[model samples]
Target chain A: MTFFGLFLLFFKIGVFTFGGGYAMIPLFFDELVTGRGLLTQPEFANLLSLAQMTPGPVGMNAATYAGFRQLGVWGAVAGTLGVMAPSLTLVLLVGIFMNRFQTNTYVRAVLDGIRPGTIGLVAAAVIFFAESSILRAPLQSLWTGEGKFGISLFGAAAFCFTFMVSKYLKWNILWIFLVTGSVGAALGYWGLI
Target chain B: MKQFQRLWPLCWEFGKISAVTVGGGVAMIPLIEEAFVDKRKFLSEEEMLDVVAVTQSVPGIIAVNMAVLTGYRAAGIAGAFAAAAGAAVPPFAAIVLVAAFFAGLGGNRAVDGMFLGVRSAVTALIFLAAIKLYRQTIKTKFSFLVAVTAFVLLGIFRVDAVSVILGAGVVGVVWMLLCRRKQKESGGGQ
Candidate 1:
């Protein structure tokens, strides 16, 4: 029953939350906390942190964690498969259908509609994710550091600069990632951050 | 010509991509962009974004579709498979490794931190890509209405995105039919 529940929950998440992971995320929490009543507020917040700390997409990580939380090892497998199943199935099905529909004007318009929504979803996700890290800057400054903002200003600065370079200069993003990572590590070691 | 020869590099690239680029299609973007945009420069950013819009609206791994489109653009069907293979291989290997060493990896500090950065960036990449796509798709009032409707339905009502998409699709098809019918009726009178 637990495994079934986890599978169904994520299956629904995978199928419905179009605009991809970012758009699905706020809804992920809402479903986990409000719909399922599975996790506490603090725990939900912690999973957000954990999701960020995983290699895969946030939605996949969350499903994995939620699965683990619900059913241990088997639950994790069920959840991961469940989350992926929707996309795999939907995408493949759409792939087949789209091959025929590609040149259809109406199909183009429907997709055109979907494209912007994806951007909206991504925008919402960025805002939500950056909120804890960037939006809380003022609060952190007031509570944690009087003089300093307690935000990862350096991290943000590095992220923007590297983004610009990669965007315009066509610089190798991997190299920027390497340098910024090294700088971040150095800052951590030196107790500057 | 050397058309057939390009298939070799295409195979190796897609094969490698297929194996390694795990966590689904989105994860494949940066790597694809790295190869296509930075390395080959076959398609400009706008073209790639158009591809993405088409990829998402249609279905499949954006990465796989990208590989297919890109490979097809560069070489042919053979190129598509090669690109696909390159994209898929790593994740499959890592899945096995993860199965074996996941416990150790779970608690490691460095691994944890690396994941943290990767996650943050992946999330950022999705948003940034979306931002890029949005400007392209919203051309007129009807298109804008469809986007707004989709967002409200998904975000507010918490409607299933798939259903919303399908519903929009049906509405679009129906509207076109009705328009056609009315036009035919008017022309008969004329």
Candidate 2:
């Protein structure tokens, strides 16, 4: 049941959520934390921590973890395969064929048109986050004096510092990430953002 | 005319997109559009974008959804299987092998450096693709109004993208109806 459950959860998520893996985070939280009872609230944090430490996307990592948790190694195998089964099947079929409109004008025009909309979509997301985060600077001045997550300072400062470091020092990005993660972890342990 | 020749470009592009889609893989959106919709013309822009929206509203990775949709549309189930197989094979073999043996295996500096470089490249690829797609979309729509409205509705009201898409569907249907009615009048008068 657990094995099939894992596959179904992933399939459901995979088949539905479209924009991308990031968009699936809400569902991941809902299904894992609320639906399955597979993981606890605190455990979700730990799972995120583990996810951050890995290379692949978060959705795939969660599915992989679910498999490993339920049926062990074989479970992991099933989980991974089940998660990827749709994509593997789909691309192959499309890839084998060719379309002559490969050079049509109107089709090219439409293809060209979608780009701005895509940018607008991304920009809207940025605006949504910024309204909640950046605009609160003045409000935080009057109230709690701390941003919602309280990590905003760290986020802003670290972002700037990292940019500077990368630009001038020509520093390695992985090293920056490792160093930042270690600092963040230590700060977390010390009860500071 | 020959089938095998056509397959070559798909294999190469999928492989390339797989490699470039880095970090989020979702970042491959604009690139995928360019590759399959614009460059290859394997699908129309509207079809690809619709697939993207539908795939998102459903479940799974966007890349996987795309792979499946493209496969099904192109060559029945088997083509889907083949494209999917090809798509997954590269990333799976790459990620897993890296995970199993090389990623954290023993003392490894060179491989880590290579990944770091690739990460930088993927970031570059995403930004580049985003810019290219932005050019395509903005120039074609020429409707800053609709675009802005979409952003506001989606960002501020936090309406479901699906609803907006549906509303567009309604507009399309109504427009078709109106056009038909006009055509009937024109024919009668003639």
- Best of the candidates, DockQ: 1
Model 2 TM-score, 2 decimals: 0.49
Please give each candidate's TM-score. Answer: 0.57, 0.49
Residue range B1-190, candidate 2, lDDT tens digits: 4334445555566656665444445566787688778887777877776556544433356666666666555455554555555555445434444344431432233332322322222222223333444554464334354456655765556554444433433443454466668999999998
Q: Report, in order, each candidate's fnat.
A: 0.14, 0.20
Q: Largest lDDT belongs to which candidate?
A: 1
lDDT of 1: 0.56
List, residue by residue over B63-118, the lDDT tens digit for candidate 1.
44566666655665556555555543443333333433443455344543443343
The native-contact fraction of candidate 1 is: 0.14
DockQ of all candidate complexes: 0.17, 0.15
Model 2 TM-score on chain A: 0.55
Candidate 1 CAPRI category: incorrect
